[model samples]
Target: MSDAQFVQIVGAVYEHSPWVAERVVSQRPFASAEALRSAMRRAVQQAGEAQQIKLVRAHPELAGTAAARGEMTAASTSEQGGAGLNQLTPEELARLQSLNARYSEKFGFPFVMAVRGHDRQAIFAAMTQRLNNDRDTELRNSLEQIDRVVSFRLNDLISG
Candidate 1:
């Protein structure tokens, strides 16, 4: 992508999302991917609780079949669709579905993780373990995990 396109993604992220925009817009003219991610983490730390909630809401849930948020492009959608939960083997898929049902029933939202490189078993393990976290604790933990995803994606957006 052209530098203009790269910057546009940043702008797009900022336009619809205020927390990121507030942290990044002033730091514009980023020199490198590292610089952008550094700025992102700092911004997340500086973000208030409400802003953190907004950021958390921007992430896609871990459901294999659901569309990821912030992935507006057809390519992103196609990629995630192919990686849907049903892609797992029958046993693993069933386990994930059960775990997901239990998790959502507890939290009132879908269980979420950045499943970029992880497989079904790993996801199941994470879900099962994280299920033990209390409501407030898990909410914060999940949000931190999402910040990692946002940081990675922001890095790719700026540098690729």
Candidate 2:
């Protein structure tokens, strides 16, 4: 596939960063979808700290202002909705807001996770557990989470 079409398919895998897919497209005809995913993850990982931080920060908060305004990208809207984040009651929304605010303040970005298989309670528990981590640890964990999210997205787009 051409770079443009390739980016369209994989761009949302990294939140709003199509450039991640754009960079990987040159290494086309991946032996397997997994190989393509690894290259995408590595591109972000090998980036300077500033770039990595920006990539992480590009993600919207769960039920955040973007969600409130219905401004999330299609991929994010689906992911958040599938996690039942879009179904929270007022009290739960408040709880998430509090946790999100604190997490972003402490870590300099939204809490990152592959929430596809998790419920609200589980996500909350993770947020609480991860809040105590040092900055370096949290940043690394965020990248890992990004990798998992991308993997899920790739599976949808590629059979292998």
Candidate 3:
């Protein structure tokens, strides 16, 4: 397939950061799913700290402003809804908002989680716990979480 078509198919695996896919387009025809996933991860890892942070910042916070205003990408909307983020109680929403603010304040980026099999309480607990982590650790953890999310997205887009 052409590079453009390849990107169109998987560019969104990393939320708004299509550059990850764009970077690896020249290395197409991956031998297996794991190969493709690894290339994508390498793209992010080699993108430098600034771009890595930008990639993490591209993700919408769980049930944050984007979700509230219905502005998140369709994949994000569905993934977050599956975690019951769309059905939060008022108190739950407020608490999450507070946590989001604090986390962003500390880390300079919104908190990110795969959120596929997790519920709101689990997400809350994770946010609270991750708040204690230093910036370097949180950045690494956030990228790892993005990898998990990208893995799920790639699975949904590909078949054996």
Candidate 4:
């Protein structure tokens, strides 16, 4: 496939960051799904701190304003909803909002987790516990979470 066509298929695997796909276009014809995954991840790793931060910032806060106003991307909406975030009670919503605010305030980016396979309680615990981490640790953790999310997305897009 042409580069544009390839990107159109997988560009969104990394949330709003199509650059991740674009960056690896020159390295096409990956021998296997794992190679494609590795190339995409290496692009992010080599993208430098500013770009990496921007990529992380592109993710919507879980159950944050984007979810409230119905603005999150379809993938995010599905993932969040699958975690029962779309069905939070008022108290739970309020608590989550508070946690999100505090976490964002401290880290300058929304808390991220690969919400699939996790319920609301697990998500909350992770957010709360991660709040104690230093910026470097949290940034690394967020990127790792993004990788997990991307892996799921890639799996859905690619088949054996």
Clashes of each: 1, 0, 0, 0
Q: Write the per-residue lDDT of candidate 2 for residues 4-116, one digit (tens) a residue.
A: 98898778678888889887888888999889888988899888889999999998898899999999877788888999999999999999999999999999999989889
Overall lDDT per candidate, in order of appearance: 0.61, 0.89, 0.93, 0.93
> What digit string (tens of lDDT, one per residue) describes model 3 on residues 73-113?
99899999999999999999999999999999999999999
- Per-residue accuracy of model 1 over 1-160 as CA lDDT, tens digit each: 4555544566443314544645576667678766776786678768877676566555445543444234443323433444565355677666776887887778765565766666656777889999998877777786666655556566555456
In candidate 4, list every pair of residues with a backbone clash: none
| TM of each candidate vs. truth | 0.69, 0.95, 0.97, 0.97
Per-residue alpha-carbon lDDT of model 4 for 1-160, expressed as tens digits? 8889888888989988999999999997899878999999999999998898899999999999999899999999999999999999999999999999999999998899999999999999999999999999999999999999999988988852
Q: What is the lDDT of residue 109 in candidate 4?
A: 88
Runs of candidate 3 exceeding 4 Å displacement:
none
Off by over 4 Å in 4: none
- Model 2 clash count equals 0
lDDT of 1 at 69: 39
RMSD of each: 4.4, 1.4, 1.1, 1.1
Sort order, lDDT high to low:
3, 4, 2, 1
